[model samples]
Target: MKKLFLTLFLLSGLLVTASCNNDNKKDKKETETVEKETVEVKEEKVVKTPTIVGVAAANENFTTLVAAVKAAGLVETLNGDGPFTVFAPVNDAFAKLPEGTVDGLLKPESKETLTAVLTYHVVSGKFMAADVVKAISDGGGTFTITTVQGGTLTASLDGDSVILTDAKGGKSKVILTDVSASNGVIHAIDTVVMP
Candidate 1:
């Protein structure tokens, strides 16, 4: 009888211990799960915004422009903090130049010309299609933007496209418009219109 009593007492104690251990383990697991969730939230907060030219740089199609940007030493400027609007001319745009024009411009001595040409394509602020149209409408006839080249270029909305009238009275159509970048916007042009 005493032995039976002793056995029952021991069993109860063991069960109690087991239950306490299970409770401790469950509490520990909950704590670990909460810690993991906190870590994941912290990681999400560190996600960085992409650069403006990062997209264009990855594009195989913009190789010509990429080279020009590098040669003109304006890559860092474009990559910097700005909401600039760039009128990017495509490979076909470069093709419109006379023979050896592009090559000549890329040379060290022609940095001024290259810089001017490149900067002429860029405006200091972010000017979208809506803003441009509004400006033109406000202007009554047409709006003129003085290029970095010391020449004037006319900006007018032709249907939906933003047409650039160069200094020589030559017109170049905006092929693709409103390419968003980190620092600015890019409007692709088919022909490099001189101003």
Candidate 2:
């Protein structure tokens, strides 16, 4: 009877130990899961907002523009902290240029010209679509915007669209506007405007 009692006692102790181990394993697993969730939340909150150049680089529509920006060495300038208003031209807009024009401009020898052309599309301050319309209205149907390239672009309203006339009299219609970035705004234009 004593042996039996001893055996039952040992069995109970073993069962309790096994149960405690199981409970510990469960607690450990729960802790690991909670840690993973916390890490995931931290990762979600760590995402950085894109700048103007980053926004252009991430967009498929601005491939040509991004390339031109890089080629002209204006990536840093455009990416700087400023409320710039960029009249971004889409790939289709680049294609609308004369054949071999874009290639020539992208060449290293044409960096100055390319920079000027690119900067022509950028205004010094952030001007939302409404602000531009208001400026046009306040200017009596036309607003002259001084380009970063030291040239002038005339903004006017055509029916319901905003039109930008370049220094050389090229016209580009604003197709998309108010593309917000960390440093500026982008207004997509249907044509490339020359400086």
Candidate 3:
């Protein structure tokens, strides 16, 4: 009888210990799952915003512009903490140039000229589409702004579009507007304005 009692007690103790160990394992698994979920949430919240260079680099249409910016060594300037207003020209805009024009400008010897042309598209401050429209209105139908290239660009409203005239009397129409970046805003133009 004593042996039977001892066996039953040991069996009960073993069952209790097994249940406790199972509970501990379950608790640990739950904690690990919760920790993993927390890490996932933290990763989701850490999404990085696109800078001006990032924006141009991500878009297929800006490939030519991106190359030009790299060749001109203006990538660092555009990527800097600038609240710049960039009148970005699309690939079609560069295509509109005469044959060999882009090729010639991209050469190492033409860096200065290319830099001037690229900088001509960038204004010092961040100007949204609305701000540009207001400026045009405030300036009595034409807003004259200084480019980063030290040249003057004239902005005027053509119906709903903004037209920019360059120093060399070249005009480019803004096609896409208000593409916000971490460093600035981009207005994609239909033509590459000359400096």
Best by lDDT: 2
Model 1 lDDT tens row, 18-89 = 999999999999999999999998888554545556756776657777788888898888888887777788
Question: What shift in Å separates residue 170 of candidate 3 from its native position after superposition?
Answer: 1.4
Indicate whether candidate 2 or candidate 3 has the larger lDDT: 2
lDDT of 2 by residue, 77-129 (tens): 98899979999999999999999999999999999999989999999999999
TM-scores vs. true structure, each candidate: 0.82, 0.78, 0.81
lDDT of 2 at 25: 100
Which portions of model 2 miss their true places by more than 4 Å?
Answer: 1-44
* Stretches > 4 Å off in candidate 1: 1-16, 44-50, 146-151
Q: lDDT of each structure?
A: 0.80, 0.95, 0.94
Q: Which run of 10 residues does model 3 get worst, by summed lDDT?
A: 42-51
Q: How far does residue 12 in candidate 2 sit from its true spot (Å)?
A: 27
lDDT of 3: 0.94
Q: In model 1, what is the error at residue 4, expressed in angstroms?
A: 8.6
Model 3 residue 158 CA deviation (Å) reads 1.0
